[model samples]
Target: MAAIDVVVPNYNYGKYLRTCVESVLNQADVAIRVLIIDNASTDDSRDIAHSLAQDERVELILRESNAGTHASFNEGIDWAQNDYFLLLFSDDFLVPGALKRATDIMEQNSAIAFCYGRDVAVHGDDPVPIMPGRTSPVAFRLHKSRAFIESFCRRAVFQIPGSSVVVRTEVQKRAGHYRTTLPHSDDYEIWLRLAMLGPVAELDAVQVGLRTHDSNRSREFAARQLEHILHTAAAAESFFNHEGGSLEDCGALRRLARQGVVGRAYWSGIAHLLRGDMEAMRLLGFAIRSSPVSAVVPPVSYLMSRPDLAGRISSFFANSARSRHIVF
Candidate 1:
């Protein structure tokens, strides 16, 4: 068996599949097996993936119907047999020599459930450094303790990108596979659970090239994604409660949820303001109440009771506001 099992989950990204596969296959100094799980792509992705799987190191699993990204990821994890696993997305590629570095770290630290490195975000051939200062959390960096893992789940800091992380097969198994209910943030949710299990090692090195295109989920549905994240945060809090976990570090989770709701409300308010609707202003006011600073809600609302202020705030966020790039 190979020393590592790599799972590449592909949807309709046929154009980028070959490069992604080649990058993994091209890695030197690491004994790795590659599994491509295609989610019934309407494009030629499956055919290309199957063609590439002819190599002994590569295998292809073609699904009859399109399972969502999370489902495909879980299927790949279930089929993985190596001591460690890496889930590479169809739109991403492993940087040269990244495999050696990631595998070496995992081998050196038995305690590390996973290790992640940095990434270069690409728009076509132009590369942009994302989360430059913050370390990549997606590639499981080091062996984590169970307490730490649980804490991560509670804190909701699993900002690691799925394509950038490498996980120990055992650690993943122990933590349980991805939760199917979380269609969008499955990777984030899983990493939170993993961090709860142990300490995550962070290597400040670039390991993958993540392609950011117009069709990417984050870009396509920013508002919906934010909403889902907020809902997921709430669900995570409930999960911890059922497990008898304490709420000591819950402040961060609450803050994150508040931020999402606030941002959503602010934007939605702007949309309503543009239409000259008073109900939208009222809804936005209610949303502000759900924020961490909700204590000042009545006073603030009183101060900005004018519909014009609501419209200005909405315009400010929609026009000049930047989304937080924090992975979690």
Candidate 2:
């Protein structure tokens, strides 16, 4: 068996598939096995996979029908026969020396079930720093299994990009496979589940190039992605209840849920306010009043409730919006 198994789940990402595959193959020091699970793409993705599979290190699995991203990922993980696993997406490229660096970190830290590095978002030649703008939950902190889950339940601080992470195969097997039902945010859900098993080690190095284009999933299905996040937050609440977490843990989970709801309401309200919709302003006001921070930020709540004031504030911010606020 190979030392590490790299799983690439592909749909209609033919344009970016070749570059991603090539990047993996270029890793010289890491003894890696590559698996391409194609979700019955109408494009030439299968042909590209077949070409890569000509190498002894690669294998390709062709699904009969279109299973979503999560299903494809699970299928690949199930077939892995290695000590470690890395899930690389079709639109992302592994930075040079990433596999070697990640392998060394995981080997040195026996207690860490997974390790991830920073991800640089690439739009053509320009590189965008993804994690520096916001604080990450998984960085600079070594967490126990339950603590990691509780923290994630409270707020997802780390941007756990798939291409940049390497996980112990046994931890994944013990935690059970990825939940296929989670169509969009399956990676986030899986990370939470893995945190229940062991600690996650993180390297401050940037090791993956996550390409951002017009056809990216987030840009294409913005509303659906938001809905998935809200649903995942709710699911985490129920999971925590059944596991019998402490009162403090439960409170943290509830806070996380409220943050998700408030965030959705706030952003949706902004979108509507930009379109000059009074009903949207009222809805946003109700959300602010219902949120945890409402009591302290009563002025914000009051302004959001009135169409005129909300419009004025929205316009003022539109002129010079420096950064987006995190409602939670």
Name the candidate that leads on lDDT. Answer: 2
TM-score of 2: 0.75
Candidate 2, residues 1-328, lDDT tens digits: the string is 1388999999888878888888888875779889988999999999888988998988888887987776777787788778898889888888777777777767767878888888777885344333322222223445677666655544432356778878889988876676655565656667776776678877777778888777787646644334544555555655455432544556666666556455545555665555565545654675576575743443333233332445655655675354432222
Q: For all candidates, what are the clash counts?
A: 31, 3
Tens-place lDDT digits, model 1, residues 1-328:
2388888888888988988898889877778889888888999998898789789989988888987777877787788878888889888888877767776766666777677877777886454343232222234434445544443433333445568788888888877777766665566657766665556776667788888787777656554434554655655654454332544555555454445445445545545555565545654665565654643442243223233555555555566434322111
Worst 10 residues of 1 by lDDT: 129-138
Q: Could you list the CA RMSD of all candidates, in the order they appear?
A: 7.5, 6.8
Instruction: Judge candidate 1 at residue 77 and give its lDDT.
Output: 75
Q: Which regions in candidate 2 have their CA more than 4 angstroms from the true location?
A: 124-141, 156-158, 222-229, 241-328
What local lDDT does model 1 show for residue 9?
85
Cα error, residue 280 of model 2, in Å, equals 6.9
